[model samples]
Target: MSVKNLLHSSKHSSKHSSKHSSKHSEDILVGVGLRHPHFTDILTSAKEIDFVEVHSENFFGQGGAALSVLQQVRETYPVSLHSTSMGLGSFADIPAHYLARLKRLTQTIDPFLMSEHACFTWGHLQGQLMHSGDLLPIAHTHNNLKRMCEQVDRVQTYLGRELIIENVSAYVQFDESYLSEAEFLTALCQQTGAKILLDINNIAVNSLNFEGGDIEKSVVDYINVLPIDSVAQIHLAGCSDVPHGQLVVDDHACPVSDDVWQGYRQALTRFGAVPTLVEWDSDLPAWSTLIGEAQKARDIANAVLGVNARASVMEINHE
Candidate 1:
């Protein structure tokens, strides 16, 4: 079946199928990343947010005020756990300690969704473990593909749930790379039964950073080649031009650019309404401002998918 058909069927087939399919099939949700600045507001006020996402590493400790705040928020909203350090493409196995903590967090929060990047952060050199503390890109080769599949499989087994892998913004390319980003991710999902968190902002950033890249064509081609059913969520964020506009950085510090918004519209048209998130990490804004951004995303999705934004929210609540 086509991806669109599969998504539609999953929603109406049965309660069991609705529980198993991507959350988007039930409702098109738009949410904001829960940052520290808005903790007080989030805790005190009754905000109408569909969901909230957080960096998983922030809540790995045994006990703290941060965990306390997260627990409070979980009571009011469905939480998504996004990781920056899992490094599924790393050569070394994911650390046992990290996986154990992740498992504990999963059991505690029972998150609506879980995700990690398609990059590596740790590796062994001369029998010693080392970490880059950054999300480094991996070569798109057959060997790398196999290694990533193994790593993703390990993570799913540890968590006892399927995970979503997100595409990272890249400023450079490797000579050893043999496949496009879309092809690599598609193959990874086919091999491991994983899903995707398609980031439209990253596609725009990469297009500007590379030579002879056309943003519109690149975005279209990339989305078209992917296994449509593999996408479970969409991410919309802002980026900045760096050093005389020669490179674009995924800073996530500003509002979503027009180009990125247009790309997001294209994605929604092709894939239908998937749960979307508005990510603004740096230069934190007031809680109200962030909500406005999420509203913008919801409006775009509503326009593209031919659904009423307010009605969709009501439906989700009833579900």
Candidate 2:
């Protein structure tokens, strides 16, 4: 099917669209990292948050605290499985064992959706595993886009779910960079039958690190270029400020900044209330506090969607 035709079908299908549910979930779908600290509270309490996001690598192990708590939470709220280790856009093919494990986990958990960065993680030069601990930027040339589209297809097939590609936070740029990140992601989504997990925090961090980068422009660029229907979810997180200068790191350690919140409001306006998650990784507070933060995201979404908080809360609970 063509891109337009596929989007048409997806927009109409209950499985893909789920308009009522999606809108409702967007307001309440706040997520915290599946860390050891919040496991007990998450498993025991009736979570007010709409969903939870887990790092795929944490569950690459078996029968551990992470997996155990994840399984328990998967039984209740919706889940969005974000990955740091898929290495989807890399020079290497999918890791067989890792893919197998992820496949098994998805079969069991059945997340609302899954996503990974639009950067390379693993590469082999001289027969050695030269891995970057961070999500390294990719050159958005035609050849690279071809490779990326193919890799996205492979991931979707292997996982048996649509893979959402997220923009990465980077302080450096490649001299050979041929395409803007938004344009690259747009073409990749058009080529592959994938969705987007828009990370507002990353955009803010990237704009802050490099000169001449603006969060508003990045958000607007994405809104203008990518298919609004292709957005499966949105992510909000806190970032750490770089020392010396005003460079900001994409560290999910602190609270969400007011500037990042403005970026999110822009996204809410563009995406029309896509599911948003609060991604707190380090220095997590009590479960209630996290829920409160998530509630703020919902409020922002609701306001952007032109709905009141009471009605928004009702819609989420009903969905």
lDDT of each: 0.79, 0.73
| TM-scores, one per candidate | 0.87, 0.86
lDDT of 2 by residue, 1-319 (tens): 2233222232112353566345543433456656678888887887677678888777877677678778888878677778887777787776788788888887667777678999898888789876677788887788888888888877776665678899888877888887888888888887787777788888877776774557776656555666556677788889776675766777798788887798787666555667777888887878787877788887777666664534543443332
Q: Among these predicted structures, which one has the highest TM-score?
A: 1
Q: Model 2: what TM-score? A: 0.86
Collision pairs in model 2 = 26-275
Candidate 1's TM-score: 0.87
Q: Residue 95: error of model 2 in Å?
A: 1.7
lDDT of 1 by residue, 220-310 (tens): 7788887646787789999766786577789999999888898887777666667789999999888888889988888777676664434
Which numbered prediction scores highest in lDDT against the true structure?
Answer: 1
Clashing pairs in 1: none
- Relative to the unseen true structure, what is the C-alpha lDDT of residue 76 in candidate 1, on a scale of 0 to 100? 86
Question: In angstroms, how far off is 250's CA in candidate 1?
Answer: 0.8
At residue 189, candidate 2 shows an lDDT of: 83
lDDT, candidate 2, at 208: 68
